[model samples]
Target: MSTALNWLSALDHPEFLADRVSAALRQWPDGDAEAVQVAEIDPAIADTSALVAATDITLESSANCLVVRARRSGTETLAAVLVLATTKADINTAIRKTLGARKCSFMSMDAAVEATGMEYGGITPIGLPQDWPLLIDERVVAQDQIVIGSGVRRSKVRMPGPLAQQLPGAQVITDLAVPIA
Candidate 1:
């Protein structure tokens, strides 16, 4: 395990990563070098504030992944967006337009978990449905390293920030999130 993976106690094999994330990593440029470091965590502390308080990791080093849904002409579209914890995704204006939908909102928790095969509060940008867009906020990729979910509340994945840009269907967008007041 890499030093970045040392914070959390349990390290899962690459095979344990979300299916899509594992496959993407295998095909990524310099795959081994871009490999993500994962560690198990208490599901109770999986949320940002709790994770930071329990693990001593700073809030700025953590990122949040959200599932957004949009509907237009009775058709539904979904997307996964990654943003730093300090900011919120500009879903109404930026994301709705980007998705080309007249109406957009966060996906219902039930729908998200069922569709992604991942637990609530643990959904990640990795392993999302291939047809769905994966949006990476510019600010998130600007960091040197970031802690993100591992598709299960029991674990987290840490990797170089820019590595997210290499995932299948990823699109780095500027101003994807608005800084919290």
Candidate 2:
């Protein structure tokens, strides 16, 4: 954990973590030392741009989790995609091909919240449904640290970049996200 930032142990802030995030952290290997730090923030600033402006974090160090839906032959596949705030997921091309779906789009806010059981604007990849693939942009894994959602709107989770690779069903994909000009 970085000594510069004020970070609370994930174990100490159940109220700030989504139920699934808390449970996952509890089971994470202690030897991995990549401890996830929870930091309380105003819900109003939970969005990436606002969060960066309001806190010490930077836009490059913040990752956004988005729920993408793909449909094929009446079967719907939902995936949780994590991308750095400075880029956008290539949903129309890369993700669509990976999902093997003819159509793909961002999941509706209502459906995303209902399926993840997390608040809108606070969906982290940690507690996603087991069946859903967790697509992590390669750029995100290259960072030393990042701030991500805590499954709720009042807090954020900070952890080592490599730690995201340990997430269930997580797949690091190059070009998963395209840089934004």
- Return the top candidate by lDDT: 2
**TM-score of candidate 2 to 2 decimals:** 0.94
TM-score each candidate. Answer: 0.88, 0.94
lDDT of 2: 0.88
TM-score of 1: 0.88
Q: Assess the local accuracy of residue 66 in candidate 1 as a C-alpha lDDT between 0 and 100.
A: 95
CA shift of 3, model 1, Å: 14
lDDT of 2 by residue, 51-113 (tens): 877678888999999999999999989899999999999999989988899999998999999
Q: What is the lDDT of residue 78 in candidate 2?
A: 89
Best by TM-score: 2
For model 1, how does the per-residue alpha-carbon lDDT over 1-181 read when each residue is reduced to its tens digit?
1123354321236634666566655565565434577777778988988888788567898999999889999999988999999999999988888889999999899999988888888888877888889888999889898888888887788887888887768999999899999
